[model samples]
Target: MGDDTLIDQVRRRYLEVNGDHPMSEADDVYVREHFVEATPEAMALMLEGRLPLPSYLLSDGTPMVPAEHGRLAEIAGGVDRLHDWFVAFWPDDPATAEEEWGHYLSGQYVCLTEVSPVRIRMKTRRVAEASVAVEILRRDPHDPIGRGMLGQAVDGVLAVPGLESFLLPMTAYDRLRFGGPTVRETWVEAPRREFLTPVAPVWPLRTERLLLRPFRPGDEPALTEAWADEDYTSLLLSGTMNPAEVAEMVRRRSEPGDGTFIGLVAEHDGEVVGDSVLILQGTGLSEGEIGWTVMPRHAGRGYATEAARAVLRLAFEHYGLRRVVANLDARNDRSAALCERLGMRREVHRRGDFWSKGTWTDSYEYALLREEWLAQQP
Candidate 1:
């Protein structure tokens, strides 16, 4: 038989052991008609047991080769030798893993050493010991199952010595293909200098009729009353707060950081009548949301609208925000109208966005672009 015929026979026998029938002459003709040449190195690697046959044979989802089960029978040494081979082949320095050889192994591109009797399985371990659950979970942060698995994996790696001091958390790619996690370093770039600057809270923002400033200790009485209002509590502040709790809220607002907290106190006659805030969302975005509440007695007087507009101006003008958005209940026409008056356009109407009063309610999103605000500025 020619080299091509020999390889086809080997491939057919290999598949037959896994319960696939051998291909006939007609099948061989079809395969040859469409066969693409494998690189010399790839073919050599396959012959030397450093790589498995082409993945097309195993496309059916069943294990074409019993990788784990045949380990002992195929190799006299067992998993320790396999482990040693990986450790030897794995770069001692994590930086080297980024090179072509490293990339091949890291990416699982080179399927070296098929375990005869058992199909050889491969896995990449996370090189760093740090828990990256927060980073991964941030995008889908609320997924309890994903969080749990990530936590378990990190803790498992940390339990082993030498793996605990990594700067970033490592990910296990192709867990099913590989019996264990393959270790690879997670690469993270340093933040730019601008990201490290301290961000200031919005203060003394002025609308046509009101000045919105940071919260003060003296505004507790007004805040307590505002919190007690049924409409304010139901629509905005759903949680019950006592004097001390409200004081804590004020304290957090006054705390400084690039992520500054902003609390607004609407003053008409040297007395606090309304409260609003423009807090930076913790995700490092330049945009923020406006949250506010007005005393029931002052509701019709447009205190909330004035306070919100002041906060919006502070966000766009002073904070250099690209955009600012507000999420409010779709049914709250009063608040919705206030958003429109401030030149914020409705961007989205989320269906079943929130659960309240035992049922899901839609949410309305209002956003104002910096360009729009600048154009409107007189």
Candidate 2:
């Protein structure tokens, strides 16, 4: 090669040492059938690694590479620690030592899948290569185990086999349900490893006399009327909502919040009564704030109290929040009475803490611990 650069020479030598293996017909078929989805680069990587003797093989004759589940790896403190745990649990089999790969793919295949609410049927289909699809019929976010799995799935630590998928608590398995490396399948492209959007606390929460749900378009009329009755007198530079402000409020509440703030509409007898909010705060979302608003005409009926109680339960019971606080104008006796009714302990009575309506106004802060709330539960 005349006048070849040093970089070019190194590249040529590298390719010579690791011979470029052009994609063959069999390789293309294997990739298309095996991976959930693959890029051309990934296919080429698989092809290149084909020559190296794999450390092990699965029952389906698929080569076993070093692989670890994202969440498991995290729990073990690192991939190496996770591998150590695996080795301790799965010692090398003498029978597999005699095989060409010298080991076998051991352990159960565990993954996350979305539970379809519409399909109320649990079905597990096993294919020839052990490819399995489990359909979960019921969607209960309250179940502790199911909640953890859903959280992991949202965090990108757990892989969902498919949307509208099912879940069964994983335990020791006699055989792998999903296909081995030969025909592995997943909805997400493995290499990209994208994370799903974290969702707000589960909703449409109900109390004995009221329904708490997300804001929708048609709710504007009633909500606007409620805002008109709201006394912004004690609030800091805040006033009643105008038409534009009402539209903005509806639009903002309609979009999915980033797991931090949850805005809910309270309904009684098919009429919009008020709104409540749960604001997750502090590190790890360990603490939060609970807020509520009721139309002046509907205030004394205890609609705010009913909805606020449901939201408090959600904070402590569902989200596992350690503490939740509610702050309000100290002069607002209606809200102060509501806090006490909810069993919140008055934590602070800051004097003139807020500069509202061109004057300093006092504020009250009430809080409830998770244990306190749980003990109060019937």
Candidate 3:
């Protein structure tokens, strides 16, 4: 301690506080096991307190941490102190410490300027400590920025703390400037948070021969025919369809709420030819059952196949469902054929598992997973 300069003083202080905890055996093992794919931001999120990221992210379903995750007291105690220590880890200019330290340590201030040179504006929203949602818009001489000025416009997100991943939904201008054909409109990079988020929309699906949307009152005529048709309903529905019950069902699906089911009416011209339903069978929409009913009058024209494809697109693209299943009466060759056309695997052939139309009916279950769906996509 001979005539310490200010730089030496800061360096000595950081070491005195944090140097005591040289990587323990537990810390070494944790880093060895989990840091194989770890990025700077992910490491920072852990520092900020978002640990136990998603299971799928880890080599195994579980991940090891230095201590109970966010046990940063061993390193620096508080996030701000941790930032100072992180800055010391890399011998960078202390004059630019705040921004550089934030990026290096995964603090609240993340810079994405390197992500694009088109001069894009970034809008970020931290979803709890799990993920951060960002909307990017390109700014030029004439364009108006979305949030704050470029560079440090994280909206004092730096003031808050802890986030696992980020979602960047690019504006059309930004997309053309930064995105390619492979990249969707919204690019989500959550290396630590292992989950799927749909890049598409669930409503107002446009297809070659159909426009799919949530059921409407006027679509009742289409739903009524499909719901009440004995020939079609016998395989899926229980008992006879009462007009009042059918109307209630249509009314319920006409709007979006917490209900277990959402039906999309396939509108052709102004008439409803068929309707598809997605029933939430698993928590967090991990699994969904897609059922479609095209009036017999419109059958065999591939309309049902096209419409069902739209439903599957919504399930996989918009809802980020892990798996979707279509149930068909074993005897219904046409429905089975439709499921086959959509690249679904015949996973289960339940013998008389479903009781329908006063009979114990054998059911065939056709299922598709997200990976398989992606392979099938053009």
Candidate 4:
């Protein structure tokens, strides 16, 4: 028979004998040379625990199967191995090597046992050989039985030299019900240093006819003018703000704290026409809300809409809010319209939710999730 026919005959015969048994050493070598290059789908099949025995015979007539093929097959069939494959290959492109490593490390399916640096060859400073040995125990990190196995694997790996550097933080595992030491204690002896220096908030979000910025001391005149306007006064908690009160508001907003309150003033041709505030909800929730009001003259120009979008962008991108919510009077159609235009959904409506204009007024709640905001981004 021809080479191709003979190879096919051998593969069929081997499968008939072994059935679904794990791959042998000769099987691995054959796969690397022939199947890996010729039949890439074999890798996926292998990962799924289906090892296709090669049909091709070795030049010396020995069967083509590697010794460790059986163990490799077992590992590949596991959930952790499947997760590692996805982490290594998926997402089309990875930004950095560390990020790629993070993809595998952060996976809920993979149970990492060890990650150690192995020096292959020692030479002069300019030339050396090195490799990383990452030994992992296959288990579902989210499952109870699997989680227990993962803990033992992690502890075993930590005892090995060079593997402790990649150990998961205790707090992280604690949250997930898996345990380990702190990253600092495991990876480094010294305390880590912060890289980015703090800075003041940048402001003055602008549009065709409006400039939105924080309320400064000198903005008292504009604040008094805008706050005293009937259209603006009716929308606010308080009707008016004196110079001292305005100054205090500005000072309090400008001061740095665990949370931030940014008071924004919308200006038209050097005069304040509207105002908005973005306050970080400091109750340990990772979110913020926007409160806004516009003068009667600027009401129909979409300035509030423009400013709110800017604030939303800032909150979603810089502040890292998973969700941002806005609470407005149910009767206030203009504010609700602006929120709707920005893709915020009305999630709640409370009857007699607030005491406004001396009587209880209904409140309409609107919110935009981070995923929604990201989808809307250019």
Better of 3 and 4 by TM-score: 3
Q: What TM-score should be assigned to candidate 4? A: 0.46
Error of 2 at 143 (Å): 15
User: Judged by lDDT, which candidate is best?
Assistant: 2
Model 2, range 277-320, lDDT digits (tens) per residue?
A: 88876533457899888877787888999999899988877776
Per-residue lDDT tens digits for candidate 4, residues 87-120, read 4433554453335443322222111222211110
Q: Using alpha carbons, what is the TM-score of model 3? A: 0.47
Alpha carbon lDDT at 109, candidate 1: 33
| lDDT digits (tens) for residues 1-378 of candidate 3 | 232242234333323322322334443444454333333443445433342231112223122222223444335665455555544533555754445433333221212212211111122333321222233222221111221221122212354322212222222322222334212222323311123222325458899889988887765555565566677766664654767788887787776665447678787886788878888554223578998878888888888899999888877766656689988889888889999999999999999887777788899999998889999988
Model 2 vs. true fold: TM: 0.49
Model 1 residue 232 CA deviation in Å: 2.1
TM accuracy, model 1: 0.50
lDDT of 1 by residue, 283-357 (tens): 223567887777777778988877877777777766656678888888888888888988999999999977876
Q: What is the C-alpha lDDT of each candidate?
A: 0.52, 0.53, 0.53, 0.51
- Deviation (Å) of 147 in candidate 4: 23
Point out the worst 10-residue segment of candidate 1 by lDDT.
114-123
Give the C-alpha miss distance for residue 236 in model 1, angstroms: 2.0
Q: Which stretches of candidate 4 lie over 4 Å from their true place?
A: 1-201, 204-209, 242-244, 257-259, 282-285
lDDT of 1: 0.52
Model 2 stretches with alpha carbons more than 4 Å out: 1-198, 230-237
Return the lDDT, model 2, position 112. 21
